[model samples]
Target: MPDTQLRPLRAFAESLRLDQVNLTERWMRAVFHDTELSDADRLTYEQLSDHIPAILEEICGALEEQDLDQVEPAIERNARKHGKLRWRQGYRIDELVRELDLFRQMLAGQIVQFSESRPFFTRRHEERARHFIDEAVSFVTLTSIREVLTERDRKIDEYTGRLERANHELTLKQRLVGDLYESRMQITRSVVHDLRNFLNVFSMALQLMSRAPAKVEAALALANRQAADMKALVDELVEYSVVLGDNHQAAVECFDLRGLFDELVASCSPAVEAKGLRLTAAFDDTLSTIVSNRLKLKQVALNLLTNAAKYTKVGQVELAMTAAGEDQWRLRVSDTGVGIGASDRERVFKEFERATGDDIPGAGLGLAIVRELTRVLGGQIRFDSNEGEGTSFEITFPVRLEAREGGEGGPA
Candidate 1:
């Protein structure tokens, strides 16, 4: 590299510096077409010139020094800045490449003008000048492309993170909806089971009153009690929809336990007799009328009697009321029925479960309801059974005495 070989290239680089902004403006006008970009999207002359002057100065220094080490860092910085700006401004990759091409052409055009006008300019100077511009273009374009790709990868990761969060929220909502549906179904089944029992008892009382004209007074009294029980059941159904609360009522009313048992025996006698099972009731003379929800007690008694008669095909079923202690009493239903096995005793208390052997006509809800009723009354229920022999269920609870309510007698 002789001084003669580099002098023309150095002069061309100097001319580019003198006219850098004018060269960028000319390049912008040639490439920034109205069809490709609007005034709002087009970069200004200062932005277009970016590091061109500094780079031209470095190229001039490289002409004398023999290497581009002084310009490489500036070239990299300009490329990265151009990449980021174009990416944020929504410029296409082709548009960025075209802009670089126009800048090179503008510089080359200046080189051509210098060679044509100045007598000392030659072909070698033109070739070296083009090579310098080409090298700088390659470095800037590669760095710009790398910056653009980095930005794209960052956007993809952000989008993936957002999608995962949205999926998590959707899954949570689905689970909550499923749990709510299950809870509603359980409540519906419970209400329907309770209402069916009250309605059945009401229907039975109506039938008994219609047939027993000789005992019309007693039948009417039983019908009245059954109607009241039906009303309470309806009220509970409405309340259950609003809130799941305690099932027992605290309203105290006087009613004869013996009469309640007598009514139950009467209503269930037809069903028992149809099965050819003898049904016997023995009430203690000292067992006074109780002050409690008579309808609830009647419900439990009816459930027990019905279950006893249902399974018993031979022998008999007995309903007994016995004094248990100073403040408690026991109501027992013993039957010569198909008894439950040890494996089945606890299972029988669960909803929709029945003893294994018998295809007895039931929905397996009678004993479940009875057990719930026992709990509602602050009592406990237990049964002793010898498989294939018999079962005796005893429900023992504190007797709420009529005297506590300042009432003297049973149902008139």
Candidate 2:
């Protein structure tokens, strides 16, 4: 039998143990009454209420057993559930802890009310009840703190991952911007160099017109041609600046390849001859008219021929076109001039870069422009050179458009 003095404590514990569901439900209703919450938050609060009965039962058992450990699993479960759900619901840790504090306060109030209604419940019982409630609250507080820390660590990890990805993308963009800036600088230098070459030609033509009355027509023609060439260069600069990968294929047309070569040779041969250098053109028997960008091809050929004539002081400069395969053609320009050195070969194709070891009169743009045009034509260039002998450049391109046969063996 239970002692009469402890009777109230036992009876009170039994009441709470038996009526766990009603006690928890009433406490939750009172706590939630008149509280404004979002639908999601209210649903979470309702769900949490369902676990309260079991928690109250555990607390009652701990009071009977006088062992706080008996209530630990319940406290741990409640804390973990509240912590995780509130986190996902975007609630603050303090808010979740405050609700748990309210539950502890209500449990303490119920115990005090039960003791007050019974005179047999002593000061000793009251002290023990207060201590038990304090332990329960302390345990819950510790678990809530642990859960908040764990959640903080998880969020830190998530934020760290996003930051790393952003950093990588930023680095890649910086590298691309640096490369683009360097390319623009090179282009600017090349344009300035080409403009100066046009100025020199105009200056020479003016001098000739002023010196010789008989050369008036020839000087005017040279000036007109140089002016047209300068206009073309300006137009090309505009096109290149507007967009990348605009290969300018919109101007593509079918023209006689032989005719293009013949016209270019006739126009360029005089310059080479004036320098006392022989210029020869050779066309393969299988070569004929084809479909391509006529203006760009002519520009490439003219640049190559002019470059050869400018460099070569003696011996022959030759231009040749041959069928490399059924759908491939090669245009080659060989010059018996001051060839590029092995170490300087890489620099020769760069804008405003010239061959070494010679005082050549040039703006150093001819080969660079040729390289750019050849690339736009989807062609690759190869060079063979010896220091004293000569240099040969071969460009090969695949025919995208179907070819129509027209020309036979001819002096291109």
Q: Per-prediction RMSD in angstroms?
A: 16.1, 10.3
- Candidate 2 lDDT by residue in tens digits, 37-82: 3322455446657556656666676677666787788768976665
Segments in model 2 whose C-alpha atoms lie over 4 Å from true places: 1-18, 33-74, 113-133, 160-186, 214-412
The prediction achieving the highest lDDT against the true structure is 2
Best by TM-score: 2
State the C-alpha lDDT per candidate: 0.71, 0.73
Error in Å for residue 310 of model 2: 12
What tens-digit string does per-residue lDDT give for candidate 1 at 1-412? 6887777767776777777667656766776663554432456666655655555565556544545677778778878887777777676677767666666677778878989998778887677777777777777778888888778788889999999999999899899798678756865675577567766767777787788777777767866776665665455344333222443243467777888878888898898888888888888888886666676678788878877987889989999998887777899999998889998876787654679542344446677667765665656787899888989999886687332232222310
Any idea how many clashes model 2 has? 0
Model 2: clashing residue pairs? none
lDDT at residue 222 of model 1 (Cα atoms): 69
